[model samples]
Target: MAMTIALNKAGKRFNRDWIFRNLTFQFESGNSYAIIGSNGSGKSTFLQVISGAYHLNEGHCTWTDGATLPVEKVYRHIAYCAPYLELIEEMTLLEFLEFHQHFKPFVAGMTPKKIIEEIGMQAAAHKRIQQFSSGMKQRAKLAQCIYSDVPVLLLDEPCTNLDRQGIDLYYTLIDQYAKNRLVLVGSNDEVEYKFCTQRLNIMDYKSF
Candidate 1:
């Protein structure tokens, strides 16, 4: 498989101090990776750069070899799930799903009903997001990400608010959906460790 993402001599700084520097990595298609680090490390920053949410301060992040796509174009092929992103409060689960699907062309096998049934959120499908519990909201987010048919996935703390069964649901989806694309997860959960094929640790600037 060709390389999909690359960060060469990458580094980021807030104001006066370096968060991480001289960092390099290459990600290819058809593999899954997990990023683990201490809380203040640059894990989220690195993901944002790879996901094109932030511009690098030095060097550059590149997407190459496979489809000749730029960062945003590559991002279009990605489904990112982060706790900070808020869903539409007024939209029902079904409506919210339709909202997200508007970002790209629809896939043949992806249906909201299937996602609803799989995540066990059928009853809440018609309800507004503001009415959902934390776990329910997490389920809705999970359903949205998986149903989008985007191959590359960046999940930040994927199991938040999920019960044992809900966590199982995440693992099941990873097994089913991560066939041809790359999945990168930022998590410290032991269960997540089991599914990770490789681990990348974000070392703090102090440690470097």
Candidate 2:
């Protein structure tokens, strides 16, 4: 099924500060979107609202696949990754992916061992995540989130600590795996979201 997400007059705020308001948009399966804005412009907050991490102060966000998905179960269909989101540092690369599968299984034919290999992290598979370099840690995070079998993928600064080669691997995964899914990226760097088909600039809805 092609999943769809709709936001009608969506508004979110903290105290008197409005992030974005009166914004209506739709995100459909098989397309990728970029949430564009300068620093501190609420890009991440907006994505979180759709991820069910925050509630809109006003308006509504809906998920559908022919029928409207219930608020309580919407999370089951989405996979998210972010720079600040912590991983199980104590777990080895092999162990982390195995642990992830218990909650969100990887795509069919994909195993924990396969995911580690996919990210070229086989050399670090037996080491603890905390012992990894910044680039390696980011690769592990991406492996767990991107390799999961889901329709919607939300990435906030996905290439945070990646180097030149690591960045190339990101696009490789997207090309090979995310073609049919709904991918949303929050970033100002065009390189980070160059593959997205749509763009939402939060400044268009920002209020003082």
Candidate 3:
């Protein structure tokens, strides 16, 4: 089934300040898009809004897979990874992936063992997340999202804690998993979103 996300005059505000307003766009499955903006711009917020994580302050956003899907159910169809999203520090690498499978099954043919091997964290599979380095934690986050069987993938500052090798791993994961999915990346770095065919600058939609 084809998934589609439509934002109709969407806007978000904190108190009296509008982050972005009257923004309208549609995202269809099988295409990748980049949401670029300055650090203070609403790139991440917009991604969250479309991912059904945050409610729009004005107007609305909707999800469709042949037919409109309920907003509450949208999360099941999305795999989101962001710098601000925290992993369970108490769970071991293997345990976390096993637990995640209960809620969201991995993409076809992806198992917990495959994920740990692909992320190059096989040695630390039994180690708790809290003991992992920042880069390792970031790898785990990306692994979870990338390997999930979801139609929509939202990535915000995906390479935040990654080093050169870690960045390379990110690209490899995306190259293998992002096909035929709605992949939206929020970042100003070209390398992070080079695969995206479309770009949206949040600043362009801002209204003073």
Candidate 4:
């Protein structure tokens, strides 16, 4: 059993309002976690903190295992996707995938061509992201995220802008890709929660 992520007394604040205080948890490898909370419960903020997109205001986030490395070095193993983040509108879908591939050193055999087909974006692969519909753009973004070959994937509201069939695609990918990796999903959808092996409910963090 390997420990993948640990949150040690982690706290964050915006202005005077404390989003979460004294939060502590450990996520083990080979498991999927669902973070359930209401709107503005700091779900996205927490995910960003764990994903190293934002620095913590207090405490620290640490990866307990796997070749003692710096934060940036460690983040090379993390693939993060969120509905709030937008794709590069200026570039075509294929071009954008190539651009992101440069950051991932482990994606040796992985190519955007097969991923495009998997995500049902083969026809739209050459089109500019700006011309894509919301669902199309989401699928393109998802394809990029999965193609990274990162051991950990953090998804925030992953079902956003997805239709019924598109939503099914998300679940299927997670099941296949999450093996032996840590997956964190921040969602309110009950259907999404069913896939998680563990569940964490973040209520009023300020209270504690």
> On residues 29-130, what C-alpha lDDT tens digit does candidate 2 reach at each position?
999999999999999999899898899999999999789998888788888989988999999989888988998989989999988888888889999999
Runs of candidate 4 exceeding 4 Å displacement: 1-3, 105-109
What TM-score does candidate 1 reach? 0.91
Which sequence of candidate numbers ranks them by lDDT, best first?
A: 3, 2, 4, 1
Off by over 4 Å in 1: 1-3, 65-67, 105-107, 204-208
What shift in Å separates residue 199 of candidate 2 from its native position after superposition? 0.6
Q: Judge candidate 3 against the unseen true structure and give its global Cα lDDT, from 0 to 1.
A: 0.93
lDDT of 3 at 151: 93
Error of 4 at 99 (Å): 1.7
**Which candidate should be chosen as best, given lDDT against the real structure?**
3
Per-candidate Cα lDDT values, in order, are 0.76, 0.92, 0.93, 0.79
**How high is the lDDT of residue 191 in model 2?**
92
Residue-pair clashes per candidate:
0, 0, 0, 0
At residue 23, give the lDDT of candidate 1: 74
After superposition, which runs of candidate 3 have C-alpha atoms over 4 Å from their true positions?
Answer: none
Candidate 2 lDDT for residue 130: 95
The lowest-lDDT stretch of 10 consecutive residues in candidate 4 is: 105-114
How high a TM-score does candidate 2 get? 0.98
Worst ten in a row by lDDT for model 2: 114-123
RMSD of 3: 0.9
